[model samples]
Target: MNPEEIGLEKPGRAYFAPDDLNDPALTRLIFRLGLPAVAGLSINAVHHTINMVFVGMIGAHEIAAITVVLPILMMIGAIGEGLGVGVATAIGRALGSNSPQRANVTASTFMVLAVPMGIALTAGILVFRRELLGLFGASEAIMPLAEHYLIIVAFSVTLTMLQILSDFIAISEGNTRFSMWTLLGCFALNIILDPIMIFGFGFGLAGAAMATILSQIAAIAAYALYFRKRIGTLHLSARFAAFRADILKPVLSIGLPTTLTSMLSSISFAVLFTYAGFYRGDAGIAGVGIALRVLTLGMLPVIGLSLGGQAVLSFAWGAGKTPRLLAASNLLLLLTSAFCVAYGLGAVLLRYPIAAIFTDDLEIARIAALTIVVTHIPFIFFGMRQILVVLLQAQGRARLAATISIAQNGYFLLPLLFVLPHFLGFEGLLASLFLAPALTALLSAVILFTTLRQLRGDTDLPIATFTNTVSERAS
Candidate 1:
């Protein structure tokens, strides 16, 4: 059906129905899907960096406070991302299986789950704000600021969750441009409001949170309107109200592992912050926090590329195009690796200048520069791991994706951080970050190769059109 036929008002935009996957120009098709997704994710990374930059003007204490609370926010948001990934992958697969009705059910059920989750997260953060800050090893100086930031952020949890749901739905439906526009609008608002609220209004740390929350609310509103008017039939009627186990199972199954992986990363960050606080004090923690924000900026495009690849891979798999799925994964790995290598080199070369941009203090700059240099040594592997995990998740291999997720951040990274630091000190702490992703990538590559071999016997799956078309034309 045409987009218009499906109640989508946008007449000119391209739609990614299941049949679109059969297009012979596989690389072009994948690029179309992945590019806008990458752009949206990159914008998100920029938003975080901008927030940190503006907030850093206040002082190290302010920066440290934000660092303490930001991960907690990410952990909560991971719930939505994890669930969204599951929903998107399932929806794509259902569409591939020629089951539009099933896709609709999955989308609705995911929203239902998100509502309760948002409420629980909001309430939990409000009640346990102090405890959470304390666990992050916040200094007495930073505790009050952290509490202020957390309160505002906690209240915005529902809007953030809904925005994520909308983004996922749009991407899964092949409306990547819509997601991009939504993020662009929100990010623009955030950039404008950040300085105004933080400096002009003199809200300090709370102002930063307010800026973020307001942007999220705006995004949620935009997405809600777009979904209702432009996208397919999504209603709150009784027909859409009922939940299905079959739809819930795959979404949760894929989403839970990714969610757990994000949770582990958040925990790891907390542990690292605690260790930094004990050994280096507030300035050290703040420096590390600043470095992470920089890292977030550097890693943005890679993540965008990874997410874009994921959407393409998922769509291809859902369309039953196994060969295209495989090709897309390999192409993504190669492209991301090249970008990572270039980024790592540039980061090392511009270390001093980059650090200077974030802070004026020499010591903080030195620590941040060192952290950036060390953490990025395994950058290529990290990129590979990201692409592979997405590939596995899209293909319905959540267990493998989850394992890679844990290995990258949790299982290997955390222990290494504590152990290596005891012997080598700060350098060891830095080395652990590099080694974790490198090792995880190696392991993930092996697992992915093995999984593909096993799937060779599944002859019922459709071969990618690119390979098939080339073969047919030759004959």
Candidate 2:
């Protein structure tokens, strides 16, 4: 089918062909596709940073409360993010094959699946709100504040999930600009509403939660409008959205592993927070939380590029464009490594100032700056590892991706977490965070080397090999 038939605009720069993807100047392609996602995810990073800043305005205790709540939110949101990755892969693969019908079907099906999953998540959080917060080390003083914030945010879980799903759909279609704009609009609204709700209405933490929820609602509306206008041909009927074993089977194959990977990361953070609370009380939690937010600001470009690369890799893999895949892979590694190293250096130099932005307390700022320096020492390696994991997932190596995630973030990190602290005390615990990724990067390099060897060999690589392996496993 033609681009017109798929409701895609003619001459739109959003869509990329296998030939364009295979071009020697693939760096240009990477930049083109990745920049918007970078902008989008970066703004999100800034939004979270602002959240900490505003919350810090209240008190270190308030910041600590939100710090405890962050991982729980990530754990809940992982469901949608993980599943959206699968949906994006499926759509990218279908588009690569020039099958608009299949792409539309996959998108519609995911939209259907998001609803019940979101509802279940909301209900689960409502039911286990206290337990969830407590598990992350919300002390008696922090617990009430966290609970109040969570109760308001809980109602918007569905909106957040749906927005994630829509963003993935846009990304799959090579249109992250739409998603970026949507996020920017939402962040603007949140920025405006944050102070008004918090001080004007005297809501405190609950006000922040309300502003976030409203922002997500606005984002969802933006996505809806964009899809209605740009993706007009997509079928959203029950017939397409209905359960089909064929559609879900492969989607779940890719999605479940990603979900597990994200869940493991969440669990790792939860473990860190738990130990931090034990060692340094609320200050430890706030310090680590602020540091991670700052680190994420540096890492957002890597994440954005990796995400953009996933879509390209999925499409290229689906089309069986090995050369393009290799080219893209090289560019991804080079750019992510360089950007992260530079960003990490800047973070080190500016850590104190960055920390001070979040909190005026000298103790909290010092702790936060210390965490940033220690954790960012291995930032480049972690960035490389992250890109590789996303590439593996996009190339349909879900099990491998998930295995690496658990191995690095869970096994290595958790063990080091408990062991390292014995030698260096709390500093060792901070060291454990970066140390795991550094060691894991070595393991990732070996696996990545093996994959690259296969990609460069005479025999065909990409989807054919993946499909054969899947078939073998199924049989």
Q: After superposition, how far is residue 470 of candidate 1 from its true place, in Å?
A: 21
Report how far residue 314 has shifted in candidate 1, in Å. 2.3
TM-score of each: 0.91, 0.91
Lowest lDDT sum, 10 consecutive residues, model 2, at 13-22
Please give, for residues 252-311, the per-residue lDDT of candidate 1 as tens digits: 899989789889888888888887777778877977887777677767787767765676
Tens-digit lDDT string for candidate 2 (1-475): 7776686855533442222333356677677668888998999999888877888888888998888888878876687888888888887777766677888888888887888888998999999999998888889988989998888888988898899888888877776666677788899899889999988999898999999999998998877776656543344544677478878876887888777767777777888888888888888889989998988788777888887787788777777666677778888988888988888888999999888888888877888999998878788676678777877876778788877767767778878877888788788888898788788888888988888887777235457776674344332
CA deviation > 4 Å runs, candidate 1: 1-21, 232-239, 452-475
**Model 1 worst lDDT run, 10 consecutive residues:** 10-19
TM-score of 1: 0.91
